[model samples]
Target: MIKVLIADDQEMIRSSLEIILSCEDDLDVKGVAKNGVEVLEFLEREPIDIILMDIRMPVMDGVLCTKKVKKRWPQTKVIILTTFDDDDFVFSALQYGASGYLLKAGDLDTLHHAIQTVYSGGAMINPGIARKVVDLFSQRQNTPIIQVEEESVNSLSELEWDVVYEIGHGFSNKEIAKNLYLSEGTVRNYLSRILSKLHLRDRTQVAIWAVENGYIGRRS
Candidate 1:
């Protein structure tokens, strides 16, 4: 089972998410926290597989919390629970190694799937949020372009390169699998190998690298 922690300041949201997530057989709702501080405290006592974290909180915000979580507990995946108004915070969390970005308006199925996806070593981005993130990333003039050599790029096998291009387009593992006519498990394996071969930390970095190196094309 994938162990999960719900982090939100609102009592209703935390309770609702805990109840909804507890219904899934594959998901185990380990605990709930009211803020980032509580989240870190929970981690001190036990290890968790994923955290459904709210972007805004009282003491420490989700972005800062995500950075600390990644730094101290690299294996614990975090899925930012955000709204459309939290564009800047969302991007900041992604930069700090968050594995997923999900809207509070998302359905139960989406939430459950996001946890599973992240736990399985894949990244998930809500489509609407993804488009905005891509646009925002492209607009940053100070973002340094990553220069990947042809030889380095060619080191990835053809199938792995296909996975990289799909990730660059911000396609999730499920979508990439359907488009590439491969199973989701295969896509996940390819993504793992791609990150290892490219010396990247996560798929978010891969997406940014792909855009910087011209591997990704404009999406409409």
Candidate 2:
């Protein structure tokens, strides 16, 4: 089962999400927190696979919390589930390594799918949020690449390049494995090595790097 933590400032939202998500057999609503501070405290006590975080909170907001979570627990995935979809919120949260960004208006099914997708090593963005992300990153496509990063790109094997291309398109490990005719484990191994080579923190950054570096449109 996918272990989860719900972090929202409101008591009703926290309780409602806990109830709704608990019905799923694959999901385990491990705990709930009133704010990021409590979320961190709970995490310190136990391991959680995912965190459904709200953008705004009392002591610590979701965006800063996301950055801290990623830095402290890289394996723990975070999905921003909130009513706010402002451009700054969308951009900063993802830039700080949130695996997914979704609106609270979406159904439980969408939330569940996002959890599974990010857990399985893919990134998700709400369609409206995705457009803003694309436009934002597209602006940086013309930015110059330094020699070191260019050399790092050159160091990747053809198979690794295939994985990068798939990641750019937001394919999960399962999808990338099927598309490349490789095993899922092999795809994961490729991904790990790619991250090490490129000095990227996670798949989210890889996707952004792919788009900014022109991997999306050129895919064959």
Candidate 3:
């Protein structure tokens, strides 16, 4: 089972999420926290597989909390859930290692699938935010351009390269699988090997690297 923690300041959201997620056979609600501080406390006692985190909170915000969680407990993945689509929050959450970002206005089913995707080592970005991420990432002039050698480039198979290109376009593994005519499990395996061979972290890094390396074309 994929153990999950709900961290939000609002009791209503926390209770609702607990009820919704606890009903799933493959998902378990490990704990609930009112704020980032509580989230840290919970992690001190036990390990969790994923965190359904709210972007805005009282003591410590989700972005900072996400950074802490990823730094101290790299195994734990975070999915940012929020009512707002503020660009700052979007960029910060992804930058801090959030595995997924979704608007709370979306259906519960989308949220559930996002959890599963992230738990399985893929990413989920809301459609609206996906475009924003591409635009925002393109606007950044700070990160240096590092041209990968042909040797490193040739290390990945054509399927793996296709996965990288899809990831660059912010396509989730599920979507990539459908488009590439491969099973979702196969796409997940390809992604894992891609990350290892490329020496990158998560799909977010893959997305950024794809943008930088000119791998993402207009089709992407």
Candidate 4:
């Protein structure tokens, strides 16, 4: 089962999510926290696979909490659960290593799917916020690459290079697998290896590196 921790300041929201998620056989509610402080406390004491974190909170906000969690436990995945889709929050959360973003009002199924997607090593942007993420990245096209290390360029295998090239062109894993004539598992394994080899944090970083290094052109 996928263990999850829900962190939100509101009592009702936390209770409601706990109920909705408890029904899924593959998911289990590990714990609930009212704010980021409590989240950190819980993390100190429990073993959690994923976190559904709220953006705005009392003692600490989700973005800060996410950064701390990532620093301390890099394997624990986090998905932002927020009522607002503010561009600043979305971008900040992503930069801080949140694997997914979901609106608080998202349906149960969407929330569940986001959890599963992030847990499986894929990024998830709520459909409503996806356009904003795309627009934000598009604007960064003109930004110069000031930090590409030789290590980053040397770490990818030829097959992984092909995968990153396709990903840089905005192809999903399923699409990349189809084009490469590889199974989905093979594609995912390649990606995981690529991330490790390149010393990258996530797919977004890989995409950025590909574009910045001219491995794939911005419009490719």
Candidate 5:
């Protein structure tokens, strides 16, 4: 089961999440916290696989809390929960190692899937925020171009290279699978090997590297 902790200041929100998440057989609500401080305290006492962190709270905010949690427990995945599509908060949370960013207005199915995706070493971004992320990265200036050697390119098999190319294009596992006539599990496995071979962290890094290195076409 995927163990989760919900952290939000609003009592109703917390209760609603608890109820919604409890219906999923694969998920378990480990605990609930009112704010970042309480989240930290809960972590001290429980074994949690994921955290549903709110952006704004009384004491420490989600971005700061996410940084601290990642520092202390790098294995624990965090999914930022919010009511707004604040670009600053989204970017800050991502920079702080949040595995996912989700709007609270998202349906229960989406929320459940986000938890599963993040727990499986993948990422989830609210569809609304995902467009913003793409635009933000696309608009950034002064990004240094990377020149990868032919030897590095030759190291990857054709299939692995295909996976890398798609990731560079910002396609998720499901999308890549659909495009390539492969299963999502197969795409994920290929991605795991791609990251290992490329010495990259997540798909975001892969996208940046791909663009800078010209591993994939710029306009795809």
Candidate 6:
């Protein structure tokens, strides 16, 4: 079963999500936390497969908690589930290693799919949130790549540039394969090469680097 822990300040939302997830045989509502502090405490007792994190909380926020969790338990995945969709929160959460960014307003099916997607090692993003991230970086596409070394950009091949552009726009591996007319396996291999060439840790860093370097919102 996909073990999940709900971390929301509101008791109603926590319990409501618990109830909703409990119905799925493939999913289990492992626990619930009212805030990030409680979420960490619960984690100390036992590891959960995923965390349905809330952005805003009293003792600690989800973004900080996500960073901590990834640091302490890199195996566990985190999906930010919040009512607010601020651009800062979206970027911060992803930058801090959040596997997914979803709005609480999404339907139950969508939430379940997101949890499953992340559990299966794929990132998920709400359409609205994705648009915001794309827009945030798209505006800076013309800002020029000053900080990144000139040789680093030249290291990638033409095909790798195609992968980088898709990643910068937050497209999934499966989506990128279809978009670029390549198999998923081929895309994954290209991503691995791109990460090594760019000295990025993972796809998230690649996405960030691509945006910062004005790789997105432009043709190859």
Which pairs clash in model 5?
A: none
Q: How much lDDT does each candidate structure score?
A: 0.86, 0.85, 0.85, 0.80, 0.79, 0.84
Candidate 4 deviates by what RMSD?
3.3
The TM-scores of all predictions, comma-separated, are 0.88, 0.87, 0.85, 0.81, 0.81, 0.87
lDDT of 5 at 159: 82
Candidate 3 clash figure, as a count:
0
| Candidate 6 vs. true structure, TM-score | 0.87
| Candidate 1 Cα misplacement greater than 4 A, ranges | 145-151, 154-158, 182-189, 212-214, 218-220
Model 4 pairs whose backbones collide: none
Q: Which scores higher on lDDT, 1 or 6? A: 1
**Residue 82 of model 1, lDDT score:** 92
The TM-score measured for candidate 5 stands at: 0.81
Q: How much is the lDDT of residue 31 in candidate 5?
A: 83
Question: How far in Å is the alpha carbon of 209 misplaced in model 2?
Answer: 0.7
lDDT of 3 by residue, 1-220 (tens): 9999999999999999999889999998999998999999999999999999999999999999999999999999999987755777876688778888899888989999999989987788887877676677677746623335567777988778888889987788788999999998898889889878877788877776777666787342
Give lDDT tens digits, candidate 1, residues 94-179.
87899899999989898888888889777888988877876776787366434445666778887787888899887888899998
Report the C-alpha lDDT of model 4 over 1-220, residue by residue, as the tens digit.
Answer: 9999999999999999899899999999988999888988998998899999999998899999999999998899999987654767766677778888788887888788778877877776676676555566667667633245678667667788889888666566787899889999999899988877777789766765665556764221
Which runs in model 2 stand beyond 4 Å of their true positions?
140-148
Flag clash pairs in model 2: none
How well is each residue in 1-220 modelled by candidate 2, as lDDT tens digits? Answer: 9999999998998999999999998999999998889989999999999999998898999999998998898899999986744666766788788999899888889899999998877788777766666777777555522112778888888888889898877778888999999999999999999999998888888877776666766544
Candidate 5: what lDDT?
Answer: 0.79
Instruction: State the displacement of the C-alpha of residue 215, model 5, in Å, after optimal TM-score superposition.
Output: 7.0
Number of the predicted model whose TM-score against the real structure is largest = 1
